[model samples]
Target: MTIGKRLFNYALIYKKTIIFALLMLMVAVAADLAGPFIAKRMIDQHILGIDSYPWYETDEGENAVLYQDTWYKREDHFSVDDVKGKEVRVLQVGRDYVFVDQPVTTPEGERTYEDGTLTITRSNEEMSYPAVELTNDELLSFYMPEVDDLFKLILVYFALLVVASIFTYGQKFFLETSANRIIKKMRNDVFTHIQKLPIKYFDSLPAGKIVSRITNDTETIKELFVTVLATFVTSIIYITGIYIALFLLDVKLALICLVLVPILVVWIKFYRKYASKYNHIIRSRLSDINAMINESIQGMTIIQAFRRKSETKEEFEEINKDYFDNQNKLLRLNSLTSHNLVGVLRNIAFVALIWYFGGQSLTANSAISLGVLYAFVDYLNRLFQPITGLVNQLANLEQALVSSERVFELLDKDGTEVCEDKMPRYKGNVTFDKVSFGYKEGETVLHDISFEAKEGDTIALVGHTGSGKSSVMNLLSRFYDTKEGKILIDGQDINTIPVQMLRQHMAIVLQDPFLFTGTIASNVSLNDPMITREQVEKALQDVGADRLLKNLQNGYDEKVIEKGSTLSTGQRQLISFARALAFDPAVLILDEATANVDTETEKIIQDGLEVLKKGRTTFIIAHRLSTIKNANQILVLDRGRIVEQGNHDDLMQMRGKYYQMYQLQQGKQSSLAG
Candidate 1:
């Protein structure tokens, strides 16, 4: 599906609120558009109505003005059933009003009054009528009848304005509320999906890039919903309302203004074409910059130790400069297309209006009223406001679309569903039958790897670097699936079981143990309600963590920062060991778990391992030969294949690869001791 359709589906999640907001917006637009029409009415029928011809002499004094000892009412105020009387005229010649005793032909045309004669000059004809210019008091009497009606129109106009204001507020409130809710749900869904993704999926991706998608990209999409969505919807509605008002006033001129619609549509298409490319680059470079920053922070110690700060800054500047350049390009695009373009179009529209109204319409036989011209100018000005708004929002719209694409791409990845169903813990009898595995196609890292460990057996795997020690542990943990062979736990194929259920009975303590920001006890239990405080204390005690942690003021409650940086390597490893034991897994793997600690700490960990190995299958990968001397079975590996298989005494008797490795390690220890 297209990004727009996906975005629309998200909006459907809160359709009711959005629909109500739109309804309010429509009402607000209607109320606001009505102003021009109301002003036109006031201008044509009341303000300038005093110059309308055919005043009738009336005996009724209700709406009649007493002028020159005669009570005369404008033709608009006379009742249909009233008796007919001799016709009289009231005309505006220049700034003065002239009263004619007899009506003149052709009320519209250029008018002049001199020597008690009023002349109406048409294109080729002139007609004259005897006339008298009315004094200020007479003109005031003529306008007195419209005073109360004028005040009423003013009140109505303000009432419409108040209604518009209320509805506008309602629309904005509901629209923004719905927008916030949509973004909240989107962020939640994205974060949840990240949990279900396979561990291998993250092997090639940087943590910073993923963080950018969750935070920076999603923030851009929120602006789409909040600012871009509101602006586009409001601009379109206002433009439509203005067009309708224009057509109602004059169809010919309205059709001329209609030309702007296609022009704007074409302009938007042109803007987006270039804007999309620039925005995509900008967003990608931004992600790169974020990734670099996160990497630098993570490895700051190494960087400072190597004195590579200048080189690191230069590398960061390279990516930052690319991001800055793309931003400048987008800024230039916006400058060219937004208000500057709108100003040019507005000027063109006014030029057309002048040509149509001033050059032709005003001098024609059926000239438009001054009120129509005023309303047209007002509507024309109002029309460009929405256009300018829409143009200004184009950059945001493009940016939002790009960010949405990135977010949606992540959501579209195939992920395993988290199964919440519980299963009975299996007996820790594991078998890897002729397993051949590789991270990529046709590049096997483990070849024909076959092994079995019955329940409560301790199997040790010792190998040099790149000999697939960790790969074996990873396969056993189900972090990656084997394509070439079957991995079984208690005679059941692991592929058939849900991933979450398969790992429920297994745990690992890595060489570099990870700890979250919480108390040492909390990290031990991992906040699992099933792991009681007693269990946490027992697990810590079993793993010898309590002895070391008890020195702290808070004991088990002592705080741990990120990665447990404030704690010693031994403390962190002990906590990791406690965490693994607290879960009470049926199968446990320790991958170089004691390699980084001192001899004393290693001895404490070895004592804890004896307690942790009871009633559970254990696999140990260690380079230290002495660490695995008592294992039930040992597999010595080289170049992704097992070279020798036996216990330490048996392998030493063979005098093969395992024996050679042990002798070499013993020589190194003796030399270091000397």
Candidate 2:
């Protein structure tokens, strides 16, 4: 599946919260849109009052008022006694006007007509459908009610602002909560998938690169949910709201504003082209850098011992410089194309609106209202605000896309091993029948080989480095499947056995023992609940590692640092032996398990090995000729082929390759003693 579709599935899991937040976001946007519309209402209705005049007098020729160069037609007159010391109400009825005395303050006004001067006075009597005379104070009284309405509209605008603020915060809170939950599940899924991958997969990929996918890459993906998701969603809603408001205010301006759609689409397409390319390089380089750093840290001791620190530093610096240069390139691209360019477009849009409206306003009959102009500018500003935000996040969006792609790439690997439950256990009668294999195809590391060991036998393999001793162990343990022939245990092919079940009956102690950061007992038992404290203690005692822990304050509970760095090599090997013993597998393999120990430590380990090897089928791969002298069978390998196989004494009597190697080692010991 594509990353987009997979992310959509993850999003569906939290659809309830998302849908609620989106609704709240729309409400908030509506509240925001109300502000400019309210301002437009104030401009056109309350402040300007362009169509609100209603005080034309038409009763008498002398009493008629002239306003805006048009004289009022005389209609009727009323008595002064009827409205004395009271407010006058003027209401227009068809071509004439009606006067209702308001009984507060008497109002009268004077105006000069084209041919005559007229005086308007207030009346106490109610007159139906007639013009009346009124003073300047009466004209002021006509607008008095509008002042109260304007104040109320201002209060409403502020109330909407407050509402928008609250709903906006609510939507943000919901989105953030959902984003955090989604990414948490994603990280877990990635880590779980890593465990199922084949062992060969790890051989090809660096540990740090895998770590980057689970840790750093997943972290980068978080921004996609937290910021980018919210930003893009709100931007869409905000732009739509602005356009709706624009159309309501003035259809002409709104239709012209449609030009932004194609322009914005083109801009995004152009920017994403370069951004995706640069972002892919940046992400790839970052993974490489992380892999390098992890390798350097892990091998710091070897690097320092070999005096290759300068060379390592130089190599790392080259990678770091590449990462830095690509970042700058992306930066330059963002600076040139996105946010600032969006600002320029916004200004151009504003100029276009003003120029178009200014031309419309030049004609009297077709004048664009000031309210429509104010509201249009406000809506345009609001519409471009989200556009600017989206443009600013273009680089972040690209980075997130690249990071997600890398994460999913790891998840999409084909080498997931499924070890089923209820597979049969092995009886440890192992056999290799014409087996041949390679790390890579068609390059055989082990040729046609055959071997057999009975259930209770202890077989030994002696070989120089690169002589296929470890390859045999690797094949027998199913670390890699056989490319030719078959490996069998208890008369059945090992390939048919579930990997976990096969591994459950076998244990290996490597030359370099690895220890996790934990207490000594925890390391021995590996936190297995099935292995009780008694079993752990017994295992340690059986392997003779109890002596190493006896001096520590905590004994079995003594803390071990990462990779057991605080422990001596012999101490770590002893722990590894104890771990193998605690599991008590049916088959045991030791690949140079005691090679790193001193002579005294080796003797102790050798004695422990005797006790631990009881009743289990054991395979020993040793470089030291003295380690496997009493084996029931010894196989001497050379160049991926077994040149000699027999009991140790038989090989010695025959004076074969094993005998020559043993004699060489004896001579070295004698020379050292001399």
Candidate 3:
């Protein structure tokens, strides 16, 4: 099902609660109906009595049919008193404005209304008409029925009110819970899809923007479950109830009031269509701003180092301004268009309804009763009010659709492929036989490269800058697959081995090792959560960091600042070595591990490697030739091709690229010393 339908269907899930809430609404409306019914009773049976002949007729406006009312002037007033509010007629008899003052007393011998104001105050005697007087007869016969009925209705009103409160709270609780649950599931799916996406996708994607979509975008969608669902569902219920009540009370005037509804509905549909797009634009700009903020903050060090604060600030200001403009446009358009339509609808409906009821005096078979018509007029506006509100929520509804589509897009991404070998362990014997690979089209970094390293062998890779040394290492670890040719470990093609198993057998210590924010012990034991204190201490001792930790106030438990900024570069290198040693893999790859360490520390680390690589395969890439002199073999690469290979003494004898580099290094050292 579509997301909008799915969100709407959520209401059906809590059918019992919704039904109960509706029942409460019925009670509340019933209580509300009491006031009008009482007013009607007072007018019909009590005030007018059986002898009074009241009138009923029809009234129309500019569109009225002429033949219908052409014979008589359209009389629209129902006067209960004279111009002076007196219950008597003028005499001369009425041609000249003369007051009639008769000294006749009422049946109880009281006198009234002989002045200009015609004020009627009760005199010392009792009233004869129970219609005008309030007494025991009136109480039992008329007032009792109305009051008792209203009393019962008020009771039902409060009772249903409690029930409504229960369901209202239930609606809030379930909506929030369900919304949060769906968001959690969606967030996990988004993260999982991102991880599965290929490297090129990440390169092309804006890092901060993706993060905002997963976080802020998903949050915005979550609101739809409760906000739009509750609002629209309740509004529809109110609209339906109102229309039904009006029809049940007075169908003719009900029809008149309802004519305006279709017009409003079509207008709401149109306004909402445009409002949806503006809402999407506003939300998209918000996500864009979030992306920019994250990227700028993360790259602050680079921006500062390059003195790019002004450029970054301008970029940020531009995005923020766009976001503000879109937000204001969305909110303004939504409010003005919706409310203006509502005002026009309300004024026209009320005008039509009031005209119809006011001309109810001349109809033949008058089904019109004054009180019932009053009730209809009272409730007419409320019927469409909810629909107008529901119309306003269309913007939020559309935004949710966009977010859902974005989320599903991520779920469609393909994950990284796994290799064939499912073996949990391996004997380290790596070979690159005519392997060639590149990142992009028509550009190869490693060209027809070939090499071999048996179990327990350390093969050192030496090359000029940009000679594809790191590229070859990355290929061996399967960070990037070979475009052509093959790499083998033991007799099988490297691609035939599962990545997880291959990684378990190998460890890589990069030139600039990343140290996360955590205690020294936590960072080293990240891969193996089960690593004990003894293993951590041994690893630290092996890399000669334990002595340094012992001097610190908190020892291994001390917190490291982000990227280990509190420590020197050499200190972080020592920690990286310890972390790598803690893994105890079957194969080790050291890429410039000791390039930044002091001579004394470098010597200590070399001794540690000698003990650690007892029966494991190792790949060493170093700029300093002295560090890798004792490797089982050395491979000198020139322009992505292996130019020389042998033990240290054998390669020196060949006097090729490897020998020439060695001689150049020796001459530079001698020149520095002299």
Per-candidate TM-score against the hidden true structure: 0.97, 0.86, 0.75
Candidate 1 clash pair list: none
Candidate 2 lDDT by residue in tens digits, 1-674? 78888888888889999889999999999999999989998987766542223333333344343443443421122334322222234543233333433321322221122222222332333222223544555545444546777899999999999999999999999998998999999999998888777778999999988998888888888888889999999999999899888888778878888788788889888988998998898888888998999999999899999999999999999988998999999999999977678778888888889788878765434667678888988888888889988888888888888999999999889754666575544668989899988989778888888889988788998888999999999998888888999998998898988777788888899999999999999998999898999999999999898777788888989999889998888889999999999988888999999888899889889988998788888999987879898888888889888889998889999998988899999999999999
Residue-level lDDT of model 3, residues 1-674, one tens digit each, is 56666544654665665556555545444444444445555555433321122112323322111222321111112334312111321111111122222221332121233334323224343422212222334223322323444566556656655665665566566555665666677788688677656665777668876887798778877767657766776677666667777777777877776776678668767766776676667667776787778788778899999999999899878878887887787677777866777777788888877687656544323536556766676676566677677767767777777776666666666666444454655678888888999888899888898888899899899989988888888888877789999999887897876666677778888887778998888778874766787888788888778655677788888888888878766667767777777877767888988877777767777776676667789888978898888999998887787888899999998888888888888899889889
RMSD (Cα, Å) for all candidates, in order, is 1.6, 7.7, 11.3
lDDT of 1 by residue, 1-674 (tens): 99999999999999999999999999999999999898998898888897754787888577788888888888888778876577788899999999999866688888999999999988878989999999998888988988888899999999999999999999999999999999999999999999999888899889999999999999999999998999899999999999999999989889998989999999999999999999999999999999999999999999999999999999999999999999999999998888888898899888888888876555747688888888999999999999999999999999999999999999998899999999998999999999989988888999999989999999999988999999999998888999799999999999999989988999999999999999999999999999999999999998898777878998999998888999999999999999999998999999998899999999999998898889999999987989999999999889899889989999999999889899999999999999
User: What are the lDDT figures for the candidates, one per model?
Assistant: 0.91, 0.81, 0.67
Q: Please report, as a residue range, the 10-residue window in candidate 1 with the lowest summed lDDT.
A: 357-366
Number of backbone collisions per candidate, in order?
A: 0, 21, 10
Better of 1 and 3 by lDDT: 1
Q: Could you tell me how far off, in angstroms, the CA of residue 355 lies in candidate 3 after the best superposition? A: 4.7
Identify the candidate with maximal lDDT: 1
Residue-level lDDT for 258 in candidate 2: 77
Model 3 misplaced regions, further than 4 Å = 1-141, 240-292, 355-366, 369-381, 417-422, 496-498, 596-601, 660-674
Better of 1 and 3 by TM-score: 1
TM-score of 1: 0.97
Name the candidate that leads on TM-score: 1
